[model samples]
Target: MNTTDNTPSNIVRNFMTALDSNELDTAANFLADDFVFSGWTPKPLNKQAFLTLLENIKEGIPGLSFNIHNVLEQNTSITGTIQVQGYQTDSFIIPALGTPPIPQTASSVSLPMEEVTYRLHDDLITAMDVEHTTGGGISGLLKQLGIELPLAQ
Candidate 1:
């Protein structure tokens, strides 16, 4: 690995690529110990919780991927847009939502562009916030899968 590969841009790209390829460990390495992940669920996820979500996604959608584009870097933050695509072949567990696992629908979903923001410190990602849209991101994906989420209390 190149020592100079720790640039903000490189780290974000590599991190997302690692996730797209289902290389969880590699992706984990890019996150800080106190990392927080948000927007994928109703609440932010701690490092371990986020990892668990990724594991669930991997199990549920074998070839799931994020097609990232329009990336921008400013200070210690990186922002980008990603289109999530996958086929639901197994149960999708979202612990942060406090809902039961989403059962398989045997359907393919291609979500619209969702903006992602990553804040880094000391070359590791400290926070990731995804922009959720009503007809995009996880909500839209679930809608496409024909599984409606109960209204939040």
Candidate 2:
């Protein structure tokens, strides 16, 4: 009930700040216990599961960073696009891909700007949705790791 500039953009900014600083606990504060995440995975992820995914990404990708382009707030929703840049420092499996683990290449990959939307309730993020705007999707990411997938016929 602390209504002092508690805009959706502010909440998301605070969350991203904490995440960028590797302060996972602080970032979690912005999320509701029943938080739901969509688009990033094949199935919706709960709050704890989302946190674990972030930790796994951090561990597998060194120097991972997000360059936020813009934040738009409307009512209880906040939307934005960001460019994710990083290099795979260790092998990791992308569950959504349903493929073998991606081995490390130490080469950098710059994902095209991807849009994300957050729904907030009571100033806590209740849900999040991501849209992969890039055309290549995970294929581009895998290529950076020196792994090529056969073109679909």
Candidate 3:
């Protein structure tokens, strides 16, 4: 779906394309210097930190692909759901959110996630919030951590 506010959606689409192409530098260029992330690994990541985190994810999954299925836009904000599929080869955690020490890469796990982004002036993404679609996340991950997240459904 498309949003009336085309700018935000355009930015989001461009960013997603960069991610699908594994262009870390290009993706970072679209984010604000002080982008904020909720329910995402490394919450409140500055430009450098966010870039580093993306690099790490790329390292774990060399061929990462992001497929955005829905997009809703209002004013300067845009929200959508994206499906991520890739191969993981290391052990990494999404820091402070979700299960930690997660396997770097696995078979094409289909994770449906919600993403909300606020545009900076009409340009970069100044803030963002991301969350998993499932109410009960991975069994072992939460079981070992002994924590529960609010269900998306």
lDDT of each: 0.83, 0.74, 0.60
What would the per-residue lDDT of candidate 2 be over residues 30-123, giving only the tens digit for each residue? 9999999876554678998787767766666756676665999999999988676787788776553454667766778887777889999998
- Runs of candidate 2 with Cα error greater than 4 angstroms are 1-5, 93-99, 135-143, 146-153
Residue runs of model 1 more than 4 Å from their true location after superposition: 1-3, 151-153
For model 1, how does the per-residue alpha-carbon lDDT over 26-143 read when each residue is reduced to its tens digit?
9999999999998866668898888887787778887889888898989899999999999988877666545467888888989877889999999999999998766775557667
What tens digits encode model 3's per-residue C-alpha lDDT throughout 1-153? Answer: 555444777788888888788888898888877776555442366667666666655666667666776787787778787656566665555442443455533544444454544555557888766664443123323332333422322
Candidate 1 lDDT: 0.83
Q: Looking at model 3, report the run of 10 residues with the lowest lDDT sum.
A: 135-144
TM per candidate comes to 0.88, 0.79, 0.67
Judge candidate 2 at residue 56 and give its lDDT: 63
Locate the minimum summed-lDDT window of 10 residues in model 2.
132-141
Question: What TM value does model 2 have?
Answer: 0.79
Candidates in descending TM-score order: 1, 2, 3
Rank candidates by lDDT, best first. Answer: 1, 2, 3
Which scores higher on TM-score, 2 or 3? 2
Best by TM-score: 1
